[model samples]
Every structure is written in C-alpha cells, then in structure tokens.
Target: MRTGAAATYDPFASYADPREPLFTSTVVSVIGNIGMGKSTCMKCLFVLRPLLLGRRVVVLDKKRQGAEGEYGPIARAMGTQPVRLVPGGGPGASCINLIDPRIGIATSSGAATSEGRPAGQLELVQRVIAEYLGHSLDVLGIEALRVALLAAPGRAAADSREPTLLDLIWCLQHPHDGQVRSLYDDSWTAADVYGWGREAAATLLVLANGELGGVIDGPTSPEVSVDHPAGLTVFDISSLPNSGPALGIVMLLIQTWLSGLLAQRSAARQQTILVVEEGWHVSSSASLGEMFREQAKLSRALGLCLVAGFHHPSDLPHGSPARALMKESSTLFLFGQSEEVEVRETLSIAQLPRELGDLIRSLPQGECVLVKAGADPEHVSIGISDWEAAVTNTDAQLTGDAYG
Candidate 1:
C-alpha cells in the first residue's frame, strides 16, 4: 500500500501507479456544509493539481458569488471565460441544441441499444419533460414521445438542418398518416396518435417557446464549443432560476453532450475531470440521478472523472442511483459539518468508522478527512498559495479580502 502524509496525497499520482492502485475508478465525492471550504479543497486538490499533470478540467459552476459565477475568476485566470447560459437566450448568449446530432441521438435502428446513444437521448427527453411536469410520464405519454422523437429527423429534412426541439414538437403536433400507420395498425389514425401526444406537445411547447425557450430549442451557437485550449471549461448556469427544472436540465444536457464528445475521441486522449458543484441538483432528481448512474459506469473507460460536491449526504437519498455512485467513489473528502447528524450520515456513506463523527464535525476550515479506497482515513490540511487564494476565494465580497 502507498503510505504518506494525507496532506501530500495526490490522487493523480496514486491512480496512475499500477502496482498499488488505490482507486478502481476516478470518481471523487466532496461532502461538507456551505462555507466550510469544500469548494476551495476541490479547486486546490482536484482542479489545480490535476491541471499541473496535464489533465483537462471542466466545471459546472452553479454558485454565484456576486455578479458572476464562483469559478469565473479561475476560468479568467486560465485565459478563458466561463460559458454563461442564461434563460430566454438572446443575442450573444451561449446555447446548446437539445437535438444536436453531435450529441449522438441515434437516428437509425442499427445504432439503437439498451445502453447506446438512442436510449440515452430518449431518456434525456423524457427526463426534461418529467422535470417540467413535476412527475414521470405515463405509458402513453412515453410512447408518444418516443415515436415523435424517432420521426423528428425525417420531418426536419425539408428544413436542411438537424432536428431541433421545435422539430420534435412539430412531429408531436402533426403526426403523419404514414408514420402513424407504420407504427400502429390501420385502426390508429393521426388524430388518435396526436391525442396520445397532446400532453407531451403542450409540455414541450413550454421548453421550445415559453420561458425556457431559446437556450435549448434552437441550433447550437457557432461560438459555443466544449474544446478549450486552456483545458479548463466552466459552464455558468447561475443566471437561471434555481427553483425550477431549468438548472437541472442544463446540467444533464451538458453531461450528455460531454459524454458524446468523449465517446468520439480516441482512447489515447488525455483524461477529463468533470466537476459538478452544488451537485444536489443531480442527486435529488430521479432523471438526473439515473443519468449520472449510467455515466458513472462508463466514466473509467471513457477516461473521465466525476468530481461531485454536495452539502450533505442527505442530499443523496438512500438507495438512489446518485447515492450509490457516491458509495462507489474511489476517493472521498469530508470537510467540517456543523451538524452532528450530517457528520454521521457522511461517515456512513463513506463507510468510515462512526467513532470519527465528532472529529469530522469539529474539523476547522481548509482541513478535511481524506478517505481513499483501500486506505485508512487520514486528516488532510490543504495549503493554498497567495495566488490560489486570490483565484479560489468565494468570500471576497463579505471579507473585503481575497481569501475565503
């Protein structure tokens, strides 16, 4: 076993070492309360350290410090701007196409599999609709959505562009006679098919033309690209309302898009680290949780690492996919938790000794317990330089100083 001071632990070094592999997969979970330096620990250990070793880092920044995202300064320091996503996208706003073919929405039957792109796209759409309706779709609703999505590409051929969310909505609104007959018996008419999809179309209308329109309804903007020269990409979704499904939908879509992008790359390419801050949005939602679980299975093969940060273990419900993913993490960082219940819950999830609960609860800022797979839990104190403190600081507004 690789033994060292917890403060000197380097996940990248440990993962790359073949003789004594500490982690089977590169999934890291950071759990702590707000303002306990969880983000700072992630930035210093996961983001900055990995970048030094030439690994790519992509952060889904949800927390807004003041006028911009908390990761905005870090991105700017790397000579790039956080890709800002706003509601009701207008001129100069970054937009991602929900139906973008680059996302690997399988258009042909040969490409469809239980765990393939077609199923992923189908699940993504269903999840989006469910988020809007506040519940999962019924059998008829799901079938209607599937049929409409399958027919959208063919209907968009006349437009000379890839099918957009609008095209799917159109397919639902106008179910062709031939398509309906092919899917169902002659007894099924276009009106009958449309009636089955009426609720889905209405829900889609909100996404394509209502308050959530323009962001995912149209084609992807020319300037929007995930490939960055600096190897650090931050998708800023702070402007979107936190109460609704918009934020969760965007995060899921980005993950799907990144997965597709990584799938197209050669295996020899450098590994990518995807950091999802305020990850409770993903863990709490059924759709997002299921999607994340699927991705977690493929992450190691795809040369991807998922760094998910949550305020507490309760954010991930018992037996949920997201919680299961947390349990499978190769490395876990437990920072200070003000609540004893939260500390115990976090320790339970980490499979650490419950006797250490009080120690975790009383951990000071910038200090945490590092629990790597196949190793004993060790206390780690993260050291930050003057420059790192300036860039990673999230409390500049309150402290009137750079450090957090």
Candidate 2:
C-alpha cells in the first residue's frame, strides 16, 4: 500500500508492448524405449479444460489403451468431457463410448464386416509398390531383394512378430549387400527377386480387395463434444493380421489431408502434427514414401505438425524417411528406450555437441530435451505418473466392458 521513492510500475499496465513472441507451434515426436511417457506427455499437453485450449485435441495410442482414461480426468479437471474413439479390430472389435456429457466416443470398424471394401483402393496400392521396387531392382538386382524379403529378423527384432511386407520392402530397397557377400550369387538373387516381387504383387491384389480399415479425419460434429473435433485421430492398426498391408493407405489419407489443409492457407505458418506411432510400418510401405517426402518438404507452410513415435527407427526399413522427419522436426523427445541400437541412433540426433551427449544420456524418464532446429538445444525433463483419474471414469471402460 505504500509507494517508495523508486517504485516500479506493474508490467501488466504496459499493454502497448506484447510480453511474449507467438510460439512457433509444432507437432513433434517424443520417443523412448517403451514406458517413457510419450502418451502421458500428450495427456498433460491436451487433456485439460476446454476453456484453456482455444481448440480441442485428438490422441491415438497404437500399443496400449488403459491410460486412455486420463483424458477424462484431464478434461473433467478442465471442466470439459474427454471424448475417446477406440476403433475395433484389436483384441476386441471397435466400440464408441462417452466419458462424460462433454466427451463422446465413436468407434469405427467395430463390428466392421470383412466383406465391404471400396473398389479400386487396393489396385491403386499395388501399382505404387511395384514402382518402388523398380528403384531397387535397378540397383541391387533381384536375388538380394528376394532374400531380404524372405529372411527373418534377429529374434529380438520385434516383440513376437513375423516378416511384414514393409520389413521386406525396406530390405529390398536398402539391402544389407555389404553385410552378406556369401549369401547369393548373381543368378540366385535374380530368381529370388523375381519370386518375391511376384508375391508382393499378388498380396497387393488380395489385400487391396480385402478387409482393411482406416481413420477418417474428423472434427465433424457441429456441437463441441457431440461430434468429432478438428484435432487428432488414432488409426489403430492392430486388428489387421499384419500392419504392413494397411500402412500405406493410412499414411496416404493422413498426408493427403494434411497437405491439402496446408495448401489452403495462402500465407500462414500454422502446423498440423501427424502423430504417427508404429511409423515403421508406414515408412516401410513403398507406396507411402512420396506422401512423406511431401510432408517433410512442405508441412510447415501448411502449418502442419508431425510426430512419429515407434519402437525403433530400425523398424522403419532404412533411414531416409525417419532421417527426413528428424531433420524437419523442430523438437524431439526421446523416452526410456530399450534397444541400444535405436538409442544410439537417436542419441546421435539428440546429442549433437560432445558436451551435450552426457547430459542427454543421463536424463531420467518422462523428461526430454527440446531442440529447435537452428537454435541452441535445451533439456527440460518433466515427470508424470499414470493419469488413473482420467481413465477410471472414462468411456473407455464402457466400451471395453461392453465388448468384454
């Protein structure tokens, strides 16, 4: 109440000048081995009251769904409902549920018939893959391609998995030619390539006409929580016998939509984040490469934000697309990674200068380093526990229980 001789005026009263620059908004990846809290970070970021966020958000979890309830607590804490859409096809079929009046759940592919398929979708995909193999066909010949396609990974390669189309395609494209000199002679490789190519072609024809599903981007509802909001989507690929067949289609739709959205804004810097988890399946798809290439080059102009989170970059076939994603990325968050090779690969990116490497490696779980491409990088570790409060009261239980 008392003013001294040199009292300073309140900064709030100085309305003429803005205190902060607009954040160059982004959609970035937070990667770690398994339980490093990537999903939790998302919950912390968007699972808030609608009032705080001028816009609503959408989240898609590829591996786990138990944590989904956090959305409810977060939404409720913010005086809003958390709407969750868990499509069918995993251990259970798709079902929609509402966490509260504010949050609604719409599950696509739930009770989806394996019979209904849009004509021409698969035919279009096979043509695309054939064109890609043509690139390697010119470089490595065919034998190496066949061996790569048929060969299995080190048992530790994945958590109880089989040879996926993307894995084979990646091998064909980025052959381990230098690593295995004795496996094939000139003629053997040629025959192998021919056989695998034919098989891939056949699979494409079958798959294109088969029972696969994809997410339709939505913010479709007119009323706030009553309809799909303009934000995020979870195109869960678990239901398919294998993710490889569906990868390209999912990426195609997402990228096409993102590119179109970006193009419409004549002179804006807004970014749409494509949070693609299990991106290995996507990157390996020969048909999806072109879409990714476009996003890496022009996403920001369209104000697009992209975040690719997968078990490891190695699963991504080779390096290029993931490398490109890393280069275009404004921020990268690495969580507790279990694989050493992938950890080293990410460390190479996350830890640039020699001095920063130690600090980066030593950081604990949940916390991550933020590197804004051209600027100096900084490490900020945030700690988070499971948002049980969100889940216990979620529509997820309703859906899961109903399915059970």
Candidate 3:
C-alpha cells in the first residue's frame, strides 16, 4: 500500500569502493578483536558520511551502549549525546527507561496485577513485559514515557543526534495510539497498537521489580526520573547483568522503529541515515536478521540510508540468513578480519574479489575495502590520520541526579 513515491526519494549512490557496481546502502564490517581499531572504523564512518554529505543519521550501539567518555563525547560533539536512560522506578520495576527521548517507547518487565499494583515479581513482570518489548513501539508519545519529539531530519546540528539503544527500543515498542492507523489500517499504519504495548511494558516493569524488590525498596534503589526529549536516545545497560539478550532485543526493535519512521518521512519527502555498530550481535538472530532484511527492502523507498559495522562476516549468522544480508548490503566495507573460513565464505557468497581472498588476510585495523555497485573493491587505509579511538564518551552530561 505504501509506495516510495515521495517527491524526495533519492537512490543511494557510491563508487569503486566495492566489487559490486555503484550502490546505495553501505555495509562496512570492521573485523578485529579487543584493543584493535574495529570500533574506531565504525565511529569514523558514523561521523564522516553524514557530516560530509548532509545525511540524516541514527547510530545503534549495543557493545557498551554509550561512548563511555570517549565515544559519548564524540557523539555529543557531532550532534546530541546519544539518548541515555532516565530511570525506571515504579512500585515494581518497568523494563522501560524513563530518560529515553527519541522514540518514546516503554519496555515492560511483565507481571499481571489485580489493579496495576504489584508487591514485586521481576520474572512475571519480565514475561509480561516481553510482549511489550517485542511488540508495540510504533507510537511516539504515551504512558510510562515523558520524553519530547526529536528534531526533524536534517535539523540536527550536533555530530550525532541518536536515540540511545533503549530510547529507540522504547520508540519501536511504543504503539502510536490512533495515529497512522486511522489513515491506514494495515500493520504498517496501525498506530493505536502502541497503547497495548505500553500496558505490556508496564506489566513487565512490575514483574521486574517484584523479583528485585529487595534492590528497589533499598536505599540505593534508583527512583523514577522522567527525561526531556533529546536528539539522541540512549538505553544505558551498564547496570544490567547478563545484558546480551536485552541489548539484542533493544537494537532489533529500535531498528524496526526507525524503519517505520523512515517510511513515514519518505511519504513526506524526507530522508534519513542510520548506522549500526557491532552489527552482527543484533542482525545475527534469525528473526532479527529478517527484520533488518525487510527494512533494507524499503530503504530506497523511505530514503533510508543504512550502514552496518561488524567484526567477522560469520558473526552475522550463517546460511540463508547471512546470505540474505549480502543482497541487502548494496555497499560493503571490509576491515582486517580474522581468517575464519566462514568469514571467507561470507565474502565469497557476497561476491568479494577472488584476489582479496589472500589480501583479506593481511588487512589491518582502520583500513577497509569499500564495495558498491560498479566499483572494484579497493583497500582503504584509515591508519594514523583517522580520529582518536572512539571509546564510549562518558564526558557528556548524563542526568544521573534526575535518575536518582
């Protein structure tokens, strides 16, 4: 029903950086281990592409979430410090972050209460909340959320104006209420689904708290603090134990929210750029990978520009799922990768240069091969002249006090 016939839809374009011909969507996988410059490469592209070309941007962070003082400062310098958590302090615990601004979606802990009140049952809340996190989020403003509307595309002045991993997740999870749904009844246009999602998130929060009430009722408990809207939304996971799944879900859901937002913007003749670092962790899941693939299919229509940075191609998953990603990746950036047979196979299937099979062996940190349509993949050296290692920027102002 939604065609990408917006007056401003511009096809993505790029040159000789890749074996593929000229292309639009750029896929750069920075392959390296700890201390290696893998993340640095991702940061460079995150800042470069948009600043140099007036591209609307959204960067996904799952590894550590914020830029620490390092990456956070960089993002702030670029635009808005990525959106971070406010606080999820309720009778029970809400999986939702109070501070997230961009998407305004709430994640729930999941627990059923006779009258929206619970003593403390984290597990039950989480289960109930799971549905909210997995569903809803198409809404931007609603219950359990107190954030503001973010700037329109091309309106950001900072280097990065992104929603924190949490903010974006909440947005994707939040149902839009009766908004787009009224005009378009399809799933893509169903905005009222957001209210149901919030209820789900609230249920989960109560459940999360029920299990960890000991911590919440304690003196050190984090109280509920609402956040103002921000250009960048961040879901700080520094406190959560065993954060992999939580982070993965956050990334996937946020990516989905952005896809839908772009679709709406496309209809309005606007374009935006989105970037994801540590690409494999989120995109590797079969279900999650499929979501990314589906979003990619609409990238051109919504004027959605995307760049995914990862370690090894294998990290993205195997077989058909990984293969599908290759097709979506119009442009590919290959940094030095460990000699994983699977990684090589990924490149082979992606149509990487046969000669690079050996060259890929010697690639170093900061350097990468750019692949796009009509261009022969060429090795690019980002060595010394590149920006400083983009660690998590902790220097940015985080309203920890309000969170308290």
Candidate 4:
C-alpha cells in the first residue's frame, strides 16, 4: 500500500526520528471552537507534507470577506484569484453547471456499491435532492428524481451532455410528455403523477428559476472554469444570499466537480488536497454527510487528501459524515473549547483518555493536541510566520469594522 507521508519532520517538534511515519492516508480533521485558530493550524499543516509532496490544494472557502475569500491571500500568493460565486444576476456574477460531465455521475445500472465507491448518475441526483432539501427525500421524491435522471440523459442528443436540474424539474412537472411518460409504472394515473411531481420537485424548480436565481440551472459558464494549475483554487460563495442552504449546495457541487476532475487525472498519480472550511454544512444532512464520508473513504484510492474544519463537537455527532471522517482520519487536531461538556464529548468520541478534557478546555491560542494514527498524541504550539499569520487570521478582515 502506497502511503503519503503526513509530515516531513515531527510536527509536534518532539525531535523524534525523521523516518517514522507520523500518519497514514490524506484525511485530516481540525476540531475547535471559534477563534481557536483552526484555519491557522490547517494552513501550517497544509504547508508541511502536502505542499512538500507536490500535492495541489483546492479549498472550498465559504466565507466571503472581500473580493477574495478566507484563503484568498494564500491562493493569490500561489498566483490565482479565488473564483467568486455571487448572486444577484449581474456581470461578474459566476455560475456553475452542476451536471457538468467532468463531475462524476453514475448511471442507474452502474451505481457504486455499499463500500463507498463513486455513485452513478441516478444516485447523484438523489443525493443532490437530499442536500437541496436538507433532508432525505420521501418515496415519491426519490422515484421522481430517479426517473427524471434516467430518462433525461437518454433524451439528450449528445451522450456527453449531462441533464441539468432544470431538465429534471421539467421532466417531473410534465411526465405526460412522450419522452418522460414511459417512466410511470402501472402504479398511478396522470393526475397522481403530476401532483406527486409538483410536491416532490417544486422547491428545486423554484431554486432553478425562481428565488435562487438559476445559479445552478445551465450549461458550463464560459466565464468560469475549474482548470487551474497545481495550487489552491478557492470557490468564494460568501456573496450568495445567506437565507437558505446555498452554501451546502455549492459545496456539494464543488466536490462533484473536483471528483470528476480527479477521475480524469487519475493516470497522473498526483496527490491533491480538498479543504472544506465550516464542514458542518456538509455534515448536517445524511446524504451530504455520506457523500463526504464516501469521498474520505476513497481518498487513498483517488490520491487525494481531505481537510475538514468544524467549530464544535456537536457539529459531528454519532452517524454524522464528520464523525465517520473523524474515525478514519489519519491526523487529528483538537483546539481549545470553553465548554466542558463539549471537551469531554470530543475526547470520548476520539477515544482519548478522559483526563485530557481539562487540557483541551484550557489550551491557549495557537496551541492544539495533535493525534496521528501512527504516533503518540501530543500538544503542539503551532508556529506561524508573520506573513502566514496575516493571511491565515480570520479576524484580520474584521479589525477595521465599527458600529455606526
């Protein structure tokens, strides 16, 4: 089994043997409270073995602080502007083709097995519905999406042209059309089918053409593409209206795009990094969480590393995608948390000794407990250069704000 070295040197600075493998796999989970420097620590870790190993980094930056994003400066330092995904429908506003062929999608007959391999097109549509609705789809919704996903692709002239969410919505709303009518089994009438379609896919229809501003309902934007060099590409979705589940949807789409890109580049055998800040968004739902879990499970095979950041232990409870990731993580960083209950719970879930709860609660800024799969867990004060601190600090953008 080929394993990517976790760190070139001892990250805890214990002066241990340089040849010892600190961790295995490429998944790292950073758990901490707000202002505890989770991102800062991750920035330091990202530079260690991943960069030194010639891995490309792609960050799903959800925070929109400036024209760039949370990791904008770092991306710029590597010579690329963050891709701005904004709402309001104007020039400079970006759009993503959610069904882009490069994004992985399995056909109904070719679905991934229970072992968490990539899903087929039908499964991808079902997962998208779950993320969009922030819950599992009912029976009717699942069948509706499945039929649409299966039928629409066959209806398109070019096999390479993937069906859009709008096309699926249309399929649901108009099942009587010759193309989609055959999807209906002996189970229902035209009225029954149409009514179910309205109930099952109405929100998606609205998101595609109504309140969500069709950000995800079209062909690939010639203005925006994911073809970048082997460095960081940050998708800044902060400017989108914050009223709904836009962040989760955007993150899912980004992951899909990256998965497809990696699928195409598999022959290169180059390792890649995928960082999802505010990982709670992806962990909140079963489908989104499972999607992430499957990706982490397949990271080694895909030659990728996933770094997920979360603010609270509760963000990843039992059965959560984040919790599954925690269990499979090769490297773990736990920063300070003021809540005792949270500290204890984190330690318990992570299988650390109960006595460490106090230490976790009392940890100061820039310090954290580092746990590697193959190395002893230890507290490390992360050292950051002045430049790294400037770019990595989340509060740097808020320093000049004042109440009017």
Pairs clashing in candidate 4?
Answer: 106-120, 106-121, 107-121
Expressed as tens digits, the lDDT of each residue in 30-80 for candidate 3 is 444343455565555555444446555565554553323234454445544
Model 4 lDDT per residue over 1-404, tens place: 11332333322222133554655556777888888988887766664335555566677676655554577666666666666676544565556755555454643343454523334545555666676676777777676665555555554435566567666676777665453446445556655666656755777765666534556776655424556653566777666554456656666677667776566455477666777776445433345566677887787677777788877777556776677777677677889998877787677777788877878888898888887776667777777777666667677567953111
Question: Candidate 3: what lDDT?
Answer: 0.44
Ranking by lDDT: 1, 4, 3, 2
For all predicted structures, in order, the TM-scores are 0.76, 0.49, 0.55, 0.69
Candidate 3's TM-score reads 0.55
Off by over 4 Å in 2: 1-27, 46-52, 55-61, 64-209, 213-227, 241-244, 257-271, 278-284, 314-319, 337-340, 383-404
Clashes of 1: 0
Residue-by-residue lDDT tens digits, candidate 2, 1-404:
11223322111122122432222324355666555566655555433222134332333334434544333344344443333322322332332210111121111221212322222222223333444334223333343443453342332156454333344444544444433445554434444554445545444334333433112222222212222343433334433323343445444433433333344332343323444554344434655545555665655455444556655655544455665566445556656555557666676654455554455456576665555444455555554344432432334554664111
Q: How far is candidate 2 from the true structure (C-alpha RMSD, Å)?
A: 16.2
Against the true structure, candidate 1 reaches a TM-score of 0.76
Once fitted onto the true fold, the runs of candidate 4 whose alpha carbons sit more than 4 angstroms away are 1-24, 47-53, 64-69, 87-91, 104-205, 218-226, 239-251, 279-284, 401-404
**Candidate 3 Cα deviation (angstroms), residue 161:** 26
In order, how many clashes per candidate? Answer: 0, 31, 88, 3
Can you write out model 1's per-residue Cα lDDT over 168-239, one digit (the tens) per residue?
Answer: 999988888988898787977888878889888999888777657878988776434656667787888777
Q: What lDDT does candidate 4 reach at residue 285?
A: 36
RMSD of each: 4.9, 16.2, 14.0, 7.3
Better of 1 and 4 by TM-score: 1
